[model samples]
Target: MITDVEWATFVPSALLLAATPGANQLLTLRNGLRHGLAPAVSASLGRFSAFALMVIAVAAGLGAVLAASEVAFNVIKWCGVAYLLWLGARTVLAAVRGQVAGEMQKTADEGDGKGVRGGLSSWRLGWQEFLVAATNPKALILFAVFLPQFLPRGAKDVAVPLLVLGAAYIRIEFCCACGYAALGSRLQSMGISLRARRWLDALTGVAMLGLAGWLATENH
Candidate 1:
């Protein structure tokens, strides 16, 4: 069990880590700003789901295997880079062509569409968020490497400790996501213009590109 002292240290650190602006947070923010709170919140479930899987993987010791294998790590890293690059490029192109109005209309239509189309849109959003969270090697590293430091001294079996820490992190992250979603949803009432929307997309694209570049430089 984690000590009260440990909890004291961990909570603040966890909050800081969860609040750090990363690709996942950026995605949530964009989703919130673009699609409104409900859809964005729904989409963020994908991210949380991915984190849950990773925590389970860590507890199961797969995280250690992934951490140790350079080949495996590199494979996942490259895939992330590729996906971020492709996604970022698409958004950048849309912004460059001044297609925000058409793109937003299409997204709104898909999000608001009935039955199959709406389901597909929700699934796609969730899947995208999932991929972004899952593909990042840093997440696994968080479990395999960073998390163990918080474990009880001389503790042999790490599963429970990992799960505890993972749960706390996920909980904090969800709160942060909701906060971001609410802020973005508020913009809906303010009636942001298409030009501003284009700039936002462009900004997000550039940030994604930066994150891809950063991920490409990560080492085991």
Candidate 2:
């Protein structure tokens, strides 16, 4: 069991890490602008779900295997890079066509009576976010190292401690995601012109591509 003192020490660090801007937060921001708050929240949930799975894998000692195997690491890394690149291309294409793009188009059409089309659905967005979060080597490494530090000295049962800390970390991350989503939604509601929205989309596409490039080139 994590003592109160340990939790006190962990919570601040967790909150700081969660609040730092990263791919997940950026994705949530994009979702909020393109889809709405609901979809953004869903995406956050998907990210947390993936993080939970990673935590479980670490607890089960898979993290060691993954860290040690270059082939496995490269496979997951390439998959993530590919997905990000694909998503970036689609976003850029949608911007060029002046369409919402993805599943959000349907929702936007229904809500606003506008026929803006293209892009992925909320569920698909969530799933993609899940994939992004799951295949991240940094996250895997963090779990493998970070979680154990909080474990009580001489703790025999490791899984429970990991789950508890993981839950807390997820909660913090979810809150940060909500905050970013809400901020994005507010920006969306500011009545920007179609041209400006298109520009935003372009920027998002560039950001995604940049992330993909970083992932591909980063040293493991």
Candidate 3:
């Protein structure tokens, strides 16, 4: 029952929000550098799994009710917007600090060490990814939109079918996030200078802030 446009609307925003290179992405990058590709991939996978599970659980319990209420939707949307803005601010601050710290590491690695660390720490990355996804109210709202569109009205058993769709969506999303993470790791490996990494962080922060501003100004 989900229309193509609705499905279209769901994927880009959800993936962008999830894949945004901020704390979680940075952590994934760090993990990759510290551990390896396998751990990095696992972290991304775990994080997405968390999102999928949350969407399903929330949908089974409150998806229909929230979908029916415009007021509740507004509340959740504003909360998500605020959170994004906060995250953006933090990213900017982190970038500034990273610039200074990275310089020291650069000197150390160039002089004393053979090379910068390689690979990701799987457990750490996975836990960090899960936390980021779990705490995101916007993620919850995104699912609120997704599940109802796919569900048949007055379905006798909402739970079973909802879970199935949730699993499917999660699989799609997990693959997407992993793809993005892999790309990011490769980019990081391409001798991303400290200056460049800081600049990328700045850009990501700006994008998030702009998105938050747009969300705040939005009527719906």
Candidate 4:
């Protein structure tokens, strides 16, 4: 069991870590702004669900393997970096094309003549969001590396300590995510012109690209 003192100490750091906001945070924000709050929130849930699973898996076994193999870590790390860059490029392209591209996508989807599937579809959209949250490599690494730091030496069971830490981390993460989603959803209603939207997308894309480059250049 984590002492109250330890929990207090750990929670602040965990919250700070979560507050940094990365690709996943931006993705959730974009989705909320573009598709609406429900869909964005759904994605957040998927992401967190995956994150929880990764923490549990790492605590159980994956952490040891990751800790042991430098080569494996490097490989995964590079892959994650490359993926970030790819996503950044796509965001940039979307911004370059502006609202025409966004509207075109909507038009094409509507042309398919598929009727709205209602609330269930919204939930499914949320699941998609959740899955993205769950699968991000950065989130995986954070759990594997960050949560274990506060574990007491000679803890009776490693898993229990990991769980406590994981729960603390997730609590902060969800709060931050919800806050972002709410804010983005609000801004989405204010209605930007296509030109302004393009600029916003461009800025976000540049930020993502810079972040990706930083991640790629980081030493393990």
Candidate 5:
């Protein structure tokens, strides 16, 4: 188990990493834009639930095996890379097609759900976030490597402390997702010019593309 002093450092560290931009946050932003904040925030539970499973995997010693086995690690890494590339391309294409802005603006102005809903249900949103977090090898690395540093030395049961830290981290991560979703919701509420909305979406899409590159090149 972690002591109070360890908890102090762990909380801030978890918050810092939680706030770091990544695929989950990107999905939250997209969901908020397409749906609404409430559904987006609720759907984010799917991502953190995947994180919880990863912590369990780390506790069961599977994480070490993945880290040691290059093939397995590469499998997960490539999956994440592929998924991100697809998401980025889709988003960028939507923005670039130049057909959404006007329709979306009108929808926003009229308080209609047509442009916002996009026929995306909460369960679907949840499932997508789950896949994004589950497929990310770096997230497993965080639990397997970074989290252990905060554990009490010589503890007979390692799983408990890891679970505690994972729970805390999940809370913080959820909060971070909420903030991102909030921003997207705010943008939608503004009913700004079509150009502004289009630009914002384009920037997010480009950022996702850049993140994909970074993830592919990042040291495992």
Candidate 6:
């Protein structure tokens, strides 16, 4: 069982990490702007689910294999980098063609009656977020290092403690995602012009591309 002091220390650290504007947060913001709050929250849940799985893998000792194997690490890293680049390119192209802004307005004018057809389906968004979080080698490594530190001293079973801590971390991430998505939704409701929407798309695209570059350059 985690002590009170450990819980106090861990909760703040986890929330601080979750609140950082990383790929997950960026994707949530983009989804909120394009599809609305529900889909964004779905995506966030998917991401947290992925993180939970990673924690399980670490507790099961598979994380060591991934960390030590260059082939496994590079494969996952490149996949994440490729996906980020593809998403960025797609967003930039949509912005340039003015499809993003036009479609958003059309959906609004049409009362969003078409639901998933009006934009990305929530299921697809969730799956995409899952893939992004699952394939992130950096996250795997971070979990491998970070989860163990919070383990209770001389614990008989490591897995349970790791799992408990992981759940706490996921909770923090979910709350942060909610706040960020809500902020994004509020901005979307401000009647941003088409030009501004286009600009937002372009900026999101740039950020995605930058993250891809950072991931690509990261050493193991």
**Total clashing pairs for each candidate:** 0, 8, 7, 10, 0, 0
Off by over 4 Å in 4: 2-5, 100-138
List where candidate 5 sits over 4 angstroms from the true fold: 2-5, 99-103, 106-120
Top of the candidates by TM-score: 6
Q: Output the number of the lDDT-best candidate.
A: 6
* CA lDDT, candidate 3, residue 90: 72
Ranking by lDDT: 6, 1, 5, 2, 4, 3
For 12-97, candidate 3 gives per-residue lDDT tens digits of 65566555554456545544443334556677766677776776667567655665667876776676567667767876787787
Give the alpha carbon lDDT tens digit for every residue of 46-113 in model 6.
88889988999988988889999999999999999999999888888999999888767764564322
lDDT of 5 by residue, 31-146 (tens): 67655577778789899889989988988888899988888888998888888888778777888887557546655655523334444666777888898898789889878998
Task: Please give the lDDT score at residue 113 for candidate 3.
Answer: 22
- Residue-level lDDT tens digits of model 1 in 1-220: 6552277778888888888888888887777767777877888999999999999999999998998899999999999999899888887888889876565655555552221236888899889999999999888878677677777688877788788888888999999998887776565436677788778878888899999999998767
lDDT of 1 at 117: 39
The residue pairs in collision within model 4 are 42-126, 43-129, 43-130, 45-130, 46-130, 46-131, 47-130, 47-133, 47-134, 50-134
TM-score of each: 0.89, 0.86, 0.63, 0.79, 0.89, 0.92
Model 5 global lDDT (CA atoms, 0 to 1): 0.79
> Which should have the higher lDDT, number 2 or number 5?
5
By lDDT, is 1 or 4 better? 1
Q: What overall lDDT goes with each candidate model?
A: 0.80, 0.77, 0.59, 0.67, 0.79, 0.81
TM-score between model 4 and native: 0.79
Candidate 2 Cα misplacement greater than 4 A, ranges? 101-120
Give Cα distance to truth, residue 46, candidate 3, Å: 6.4
